[model samples]
Target chain A: MSKIGALIFGFNEYSLEIANNIGHKFGEIEIFSMSGAKEALEKEFAYPINRFDLSEDWGDLNERFDMEKSTAFCTLDDTAENIFLTISLRSSFKNLIIIAIAQNKESADKLSLAGANKVIPLVQTTSAMIADMLDKPVITEVLHNILYEKSSLKIAQIRVDKDDYFDGKYPTDIEWSREHGVIVLSVMHEDMSSEFIYSSKAKHHAIKNGDIFVVVGYERDIEEFEKLIGSRCDVSWSHWSR
Target chain B: MFKGWIVDIAYAINVSDSYIQTKRFFYNLLENDSYRFKKYFDMVMMALIFASVFIFIREVKYHVDDSLLFFNNIIISLIFLAEYLLRFWISSSITEVIIEQSEYDLMLSREFRLSKALRKIARQKLEYILSIRAIIDLLAILPFFHQFRLLRIFILFRVFKLFRYARSFQTFVSVLATKKFEFLTLSIFASIVIFVSSVLIYVMEANNPDSPVNTLYDAIYWSIVTISTVGYGDITPITYEGRMVAMIVIIAGIAVLAFTTSLAVSAFTEKLDEIKETKTVDDISKLKKFYIICGYEHISKEVAKQLVKNSNSLIVLDEDPKRVENAKSDGFVALNYDPGNIDSYKRLNIDLQRQVKAILCLRESDVENVYTTLTVRSIHKKIYILSLLMKEEHRNKLLYAGVNEIVYPKELVGMIAREFVGKPVAFEVIHALRSDYTNINIEEIIITPRMLRNAPLVADLHNARYRVILLGVYKKERKRFFFNPIDSTILEEGDYLVVIGNVLFIREFERSLYR
Candidate 1:
């Protein structure tokens, strides 16, 4: 099994925040800065820092860490620099997971095109949505518990190993959240493309082998769901160790 | 027995139903501009005022026809007299006044005094007659008497009656009325200058035979003409002292002219923004419901854009002029008013119970957001306020300040990042659903009273025929969101169905359910 590690680019506020918040979850973390090591020393940044040049081939990265097992965060304050870093990292490692911070929708689109697997737009669109949905107090409590507070609400990806059960089952065939004890959010195809289960397009697609079901539920419920579906859990968060 | 009978008659007249109805009808016709019937009444009144003034002007220069004279003198006068009496009658209720007087006498264990009640009623009517509007109305009707030469002079006051009909004229008067202090000061200064200059010119030029300033009247007229810059040139002072006096008066005239123009211009400039703001408020009030955004920042912009997409009217308010301008350029109704100011809320003229759906305090700082929330809450006890909490520590303070909802952007972003690191696909699905990057959206449709009456099951909504997914049902009465509610669960009024699908399909599903 590959060890879980993180490669964080840029020594800025956003990068520092992500490192400080989710840094310990990964087994190892390496922070890269465009500026020299002296500035990092002056600030006394907690994470181990490395100086990197944009034009250089990442020869030291491959030798130091397993690229497939590691996740890279491109969080440089400058949009162009972040995009270029994402492109370089993507070109070097095909299996590496890259998440980039975008200041706006335009940059977010550009970052995605530049091979970032996920783009976190720095705007408050998500928060605004959650705020609008706060009329239902239970949802707010659930979301808050899942986010800032520790709770049993685990979001996991279960790989479909047994093909016969899901061979011809559409996403809407069974009640997943009620009878199954899990809210199946989306289904990821073998090709890495995913669609939200509730979407109209998702209604046409059938679940099959090698498909991954992303679900949100309690710890015991998720485990039970995994056993019932006869699928191995590829990844799970929220109930993991600090 | 006779006295008792007389008292009964008076009581009957006081409570007469037809009398109250007639009075109410006239009150609505004259005072309620929004009443449909008042529009017609106003038009007729305007036509009469114009016709009477026209005839009065015609009579000044030429002979008037006898029939037109009779119409203006009799028909219009009778209408005016009726209007005056109606206005007086409505100004105070005699029945209420008499009832109160009799009640007071009974409380004191004394006989009811008719003369005392009459005195009180007369004083109230006198107060109404002394008012400026009533005085104008009296002058307008007096010209119809035509027999009193002095009352005929009041015919000019008929023109002032036009002020009552035209709303724009009232606005203009109000705008000038705000500069009462400045105008008062300016007029005093001008008067002093005119007085001194006229006296000086008279003393210097009256001794000469060539001078037209033989009396104080001529001097005053000359000074006024010079000071106003009319330069009639009918009077000239041949002496050097008089010419010097002319020079001083002319310079003073120019000074007074500049000061007056600047004062008027400043007053208009100050009132122009207020007028525009009032118009915006009026327009918003006309909407059945609307939202007020306290700041025009990125979060607010996003919320506003979404609200606009959902076809909800909103007004963006920002103290920052630049942000306000940006919002305006982006095709939003934006006002440069500070959210932390109580006067701004007062200016909105929000009816505490309706029209305003919510106020979103999306300012960048916690202090500003909290202050805005407090200001809004202080004035509107029940107005829904949603504030953006910049820091987690300020959450309690915001809630304490009476924010109905607090959205912490940092925590939300942090959560997204954590989820992105662990389950990228789930992150993608959620991000796509929220950003409208994909055509999918998680929308909440309220099960209105129309739908609850039918008592549809959740299973019906979950059917594939709707072409949407029923994620959950938010039971409003219970204040809980039941995840994937049981198929047998009956939908209740105010319960919100959280569904995800293409926007068009979701709308279709809502319409079908509502139907």
Candidate 2:
């Protein structure tokens, strides 16, 4: 059995971050940048990056990777391109695992229909959420929890239901820290826009019903948070429920 | 008999209360019955009840043998009467003893223990006698009085008592008890639909001379027959409006009937699923601290077998159903589901992610393992991930994917072969130490804050008369393992104490330090 290499399609902030976060785990790392030249990505990542058009046949992919062993990650900036990449790769490599990213539910459905094994929805505040996780002791602690999994504390996404208490309040008003046993990661607006609570724009955003908050806490503490805010909080990303 | 009553009062006073042998036997027979002697007792009682019922049913017939019927009736009546008296005797309360003690012996005042005890006994008797089982028992004997036709119904009630003896019938009754709400809902909806349709048909066709529903009652019967799809052809709608109502009724009947069928199917499936889950619950406990091996490949199997041998807890997930069933049959906890599926991962209760010791990703396809590692890392970044490297390049990929260790089988075997040729004695010794389960073992124990709070320091550990040799102390802060540390080396919380010793000594030593 050949060791699986990573096939990252498209070049974007998410693509770059994902490449960096997951680049070391693969035997061979290749980036298919639609807009950038090979020089930039190779210099940046110290790995091979090729300029390619997704519309073209990826016949060379079979030679580069054992089609039976490689995983194709479609992290193209545009949802449609990712869906396109998913379909193209799936058509070529019938046995390979194809993962694609979607910006919303509709694209997720499209990517899934296009034969992506997993479609992770990229929320608006993902970068900011990552930044929040990188904060001084919090990042180390979060990393510790993720790496060692030695604590019961978990990250949960909760929707802000209709509540009288938080209707007129700002995001900064709620003490979602040690006192409440929860650290608010980000807040998703009714328009599907999301921002980390620490961001300048989010700090001023007024709390409203139907907004979703991503928080990190223990199960009981999360339940307690639900009780206090009267919000419908979920312990997992429900899109994965299917 | 009077002396016996007096003795009962004396004994009750002597012991405060008594669980007499007869009382216990009868109590168990009625209340705490199992598939034992009580089962046989029930079978016998059921047979007798059914026989008496059979005789009564025959006597109701025109040409029954009168003389034999009378003899059998008298015999069955005597047995039922005796059983009934025995049940009554067992139900007697110690309340009377307390009452007598309070009222006459202790000379307690009104509204004291005496009156309360008497009231309790009276209430117990009232409750017992009025209970359905007790009523059925009483009715079974009353059938000997064939004078009244109404008593014949009670004789039929005796057959209902088979529910107590037959397991399948008992389950039927139990399922009905749980599903009464659904059945009730269906019945109520049916009734409403039937009533409305009947009224509409009756009102619309009342003036039509050709209509079979000349009367309101006939329209109701016609409506029910149409809705049930059991049309007897005796009644038919004549007017166009009446025919439309009948068509609507038929269509609505199918829809409502399908809904009822769906409810039954869902309920039955839910019950089966509950039973299956509960059986698994008994096979394994809620994972507090355990290892998760993602695939049951040969490599992962070897890993899991060792974990089990060492008494470590684990759950194995394999995409292959046959492999899953195979592992389960071998007395290991296994689940058949694609580990790459996030929902299956969620089912793993990854929220309590810390309980996971480590994830051994040994999928035949390294790509799947990489995805699994990425997913597991995304959800629980702190969990240790060990993957078997299928290709040389996958090492870096797996590491980038957040795999803690990538074991290359060929490389490991090659290294071991080289060691066997160059340093045979050392290899043998190392292998022997680990393989000799009954004698030697290597183990790691972490130093917790609780240990620092109560137990002796690291220096004291060296002199604690331990037969085990201290191999190293892993410092969490510095992320370094100091081998052969000096006695004065200060110990910190979260230090791993790596040691080699006799298996028994290691076990005892671990127990002492952890305790």
Candidate 3:
């Protein structure tokens, strides 16, 4: 069995999501929160946990957790103050990977100065969210597949507007794979539900006005597809709320 | 006659045609004269005639046979009557004595009737001061018997005739006319107090021997003196009823004085405050072609310093007095008030908003900058605005909010730093270009399509007007800059010409291109 340990501190909804996401990545994940991670274990999953107050002594936290065994410590505190805790942990556990959140540029600077392994501003998350929505329904599912099941080819969403020439065509009839070097994985209709267009059920379905075509291609091929779509097309996701 | 003399003076001053003709007539009358003393002599004679009227009034009170006074009065009346007849003869119309000669001519030439002429005469009567004064002078010199000595009190009304000679008196009259409503309110209050006090005194001291309020007339005189707060002490109230009336009068007098004093003080203070406020605004605005920053926030300090370093005039407008004072302490011209207020804007002379080179709104919040941008755009549509946007989502909103440029400070600083770390030398060059301390830089210019005519190539533009090199031209059409354009590359009007040179040469080059 591969022994893997995770340290989660300052856990909120976002931190909990990150914890849940990271749990599936490893064989054994030990979660720790500055508050409430232990209580959360009773609902669905069980892991060895340690709870510590943020205001408590750093020395007591060092004595409690075995730093060498912990593979990664993630801080989800949306402030520069989290970097101090990260620094304290980094001093005890020299090889542990530390990732922390920053509220803004100024806080990001302080976090970087405090020697966290990685510091990401909250705005960076928004940027990532924007980049993801630019790829939409399938891209999200593909990301989930890659992170959980180690998939190579991934699904991505592409918008079809009035200006696009591919309107009113069936996906199966179009030679997207041969001509454009991309595969049509699925199609999302105007009602915002996805159908696997390459499957038998969706073979007869014609492309409508507000259809989103799900494509699976290499990164370079995706780049080429984006260029073909051109910069004039508005790539915002109307369904997702930030 | 006095009207003719005034017209003569006016002609001597070259103000009217009749005056000019009369002046010529007078010049002919006093020809071969080394001294032009007739004008001065006439004025002195008029003064003496007025003085003698007053003297005659005082003398007639003592004696019945005032021979010298009567003779003097007759001579003055004859001179005045002759003068009046001469003025009437020289003029073209009967209405000339009352209406202005120019107005009379205008009306008569248009064939106005007697009724129309009378209306015109009445309208001009108030304007014809010389004619009115001459009429008063005629009344003063007219002879009267001992019983009509009371009529001689009309001679005191002649004192008003001196006003025509006095400039200060004319000014006082004009001011009083303008402030007629204020004076009327004051006088009404005074009259009410006088009427009430007089009636009370008459009722109270009807039988008191020591009291000066023995009659209604005496009571009126006493009331006048008391309410004026003069307290002449020529009259006193001795009875209980009299004392009660006196007490009420004294109290009312105090109230009236206080009320009038407060009114004067408030008006004076308000005027003084307005002047002071305007002076402060003027001091800030006198900084010619200054940048007006409409808010005080974190970015303002750096912006102010940067502008100051470039020797550019800066006027900071902030509602917080302390912030304004702080900016002033930091060597910036600052106005400690809202720039958006109409009165404040007026005081700053910002209605002529073209004088301001640029407006900057860097308030902590995007909403505040949005409002400031709107106000700036309303005042001057072309003024360049650099505003700070708090959120990335608000960037589009602020762009449509009328700001020429929106800066997300966090993102900008981060990007700059990132560039600095990635390409140090390139970052240094960009920094030097942006700095006030450095000489070389890239400049952005807007060219319209019309300016593309004749194809003045960019290569020839180098050292054409100033010793500046045209590095590139950014065409909005192409959405890219053409680096180092040759003679073959055609120059277009709406192209932004990026030039590299010293600051002085760059400025001269810009001026030449624009000119």
DockQ for each numbered candidate:
0.23, 0.01, 0.02
What tens-digit string does per-residue lDDT give for candidate 2 at B1-515? Answer: 55345546656755553446656777777655331377678878788877766776676666667776675566766777787777776676554555455555445443334445557668778787888877877877776776776866676766766665665565445545567798898889889989999999999988888777888899899988888877798999888898999899899789777877787666667676444544454343446677777887655665666567657788888889888877888778887767777777765544335567777787867899999888888877687777777666677889999988666543433333233222222333344334533255546677777666645466666422455556456677987655446557777887777665566677777777766
lDDT of 3 by residue, B5-41 (tens): 5445434455567766775575433331222364464
Over A1-242, each residue of candidate 1 has an lDDT whose tens digit, in order, gives 34567888887656666776675468788788898845647357677888898997988888788787688889887889889999999899877888888878899999989988777776745534744453334444544454443665666778887767666878888777667878777887776667777665567887777778877777788888888676645453222211
Q: What share of the true interface contacts does each candidate keep?
A: 0.27, 0.00, 0.00
Highest DockQ: give the candidate number.
Answer: 1
Q: What's the best-to-worst order under lDDT?
A: 1, 2, 3
Chain A TM value for model 2: 0.52
What does candidate 1's lDDT look like per residue over B307-334, in tens digits? 7876778898899999999999999999
* Candidate maximizing TM-score: 1
Q: Tell me the spans in candidate 3 whose CA falls farther than 4 Å from its real position.
A: A1-242, B1-276, B284-288, B351-353, B378-382, B417-425, B436-470, B474-480, B490-515
Q: How well is each residue in A58-154 modelled by candidate 2, as lDDT tens digits?
A: 7777766777756667877777777887888888777776767776557878999998765655431121222222221233233334222345655
| Tens-digit per-residue lDDT, A180-228, candidate 3 | 6665545556665555444444567776556666554555665576566
By TM-score, the better pick of 1 and 2 is: 1
Q: What is the Å distance of residue B479 in model 3 from its true position?
A: 8.3
